[model samples]
Target: MSNLVTMTIASEAFLLLSFIIIILSTKNPKRNVLWVILFIIGAAPHLYLAIDHVTNDYMDANIGLGLAFMFTWVYSVAAFIIAIILLVKKKRDNNISQEQ
Candidate 1:
């Protein structure tokens, strides 16, 4: 198996694990942010490898790896957007509830 494949698997696993952690968390803003940060960190290694491999075309790689890297980046961005939306919604809900 190629290193790219390994990195892709690891990246996906970490992303999934992060989602699970976020879902299981008890709706704490601080904790949720921490988890998202950790998830991003976990994803960094894969993203780096993907970029390096794609940019340099190193290690006799093919275009498939490039596609995977692009997909991973897209997923990361989507995850961030979703997290932010959720956090904002939670804050708004909290504020409304408190005022009432």
Candidate 2:
């Protein structure tokens, strides 16, 4: 209906897609890094916005939340958590594989 709505939907879609890629890539050690990269891609925007929001001060900030901004933060945090989990799992899997 509007540009903001479209962007919000796209951001959510990215989060979902990256999450699935990360989960599937976990089984392939070589692809695990790709998955983490996708995860960072997903997190980058929100993290950028969140950091900007803080650094610029919410009042002077150019990006207008208007509303629905909370979801961006939520998505960013979720992406970050997923990335950390994937990294830890990858490392653990590497250790186990090496022992054999």
Candidate 3:
């Protein structure tokens, strides 16, 4: 019932929703870019949380906090990377289709 717990749950939910959107978009070529945008939007909270934690000295040696922080940080970075790759591939595919 704490703020941290709420935020953590919300962040995880968003990330999961983003993943689902990305997976569903793969089958619907026209919506790929839109899904990527949705994924970024979903990931925004975790990204913000990770940056805030880094800037505010929230990451300490406490095992639980450290693990949570690391998980959020890694998930945010991985999501960003995956989104970027998907966006680029979507653009490339669009261009290829246009050329044909």
Candidate 4:
């Protein structure tokens, strides 16, 4: 296997794995299946693009490959930020309800 293909697979797998780890480790009672589905859908395209890169089997990929990697980064960051926001919001809401 080409180095580029190996690298592409590693990075995408890592991103997917880390996200799943965080979701499983920190189980939030308020967060529903919708968030999981949203992340899976959002990640699908990015991962699909990565497959294209892997098939190329070249060390130096085209500029568009960079864009696909960017997509993965953006998706992961947005998912993480949105998850944190949701978790915090739920925590605050629960606290307020308990106090009242």
**TM-score: which candidate is best?**
4
Residue 42 of model 2: what lDDT?
54
lDDT of 4: 0.66
Please list all clashing residue pairs in model 4, or write none if there are none: none
Please give the ranking of all candidate structures by lDDT, highest first, separated by commas: 4, 1, 3, 2
Worst lDDT run of 10 residues, candidate 4, spans 21-30
Instruction: Work out the TM-score per prediction.
Output: 0.48, 0.39, 0.49, 0.59
lDDT of 4 by residue, 1-100 (tens): 4765776676667566546645654556456465567667766766676677666666774677677667777776776666566567768878999999
lDDT against the true structure, each candidate: 0.64, 0.62, 0.62, 0.66
What are the runs in model 4 whose C-alpha is more than 4 Å off? 1-37, 58-60
Q: How large is the C-alpha RMSD of every model relative to the true structure?
A: 8.6, 10.5, 9.0, 4.4
Error of 3 at 34 (Å): 22
Q: Candidate 1, TM-score vs. the true structure? A: 0.48
How should the candidates be ordered by TM-score, best one leading? 4, 3, 1, 2
* Candidate 2, 1-100: lDDT as tens digits: 2564566566666676657746663666777677667656655665465445445644453544433356555765676577668868888989999999
CA error at residue 84 for candidate 4, angstroms:
1.1
1 against 2, candidate with superior lDDT: 1
Error of 1 at 63 (Å): 1.1
TM-score preference between candidates 1 and 2, better one? 1
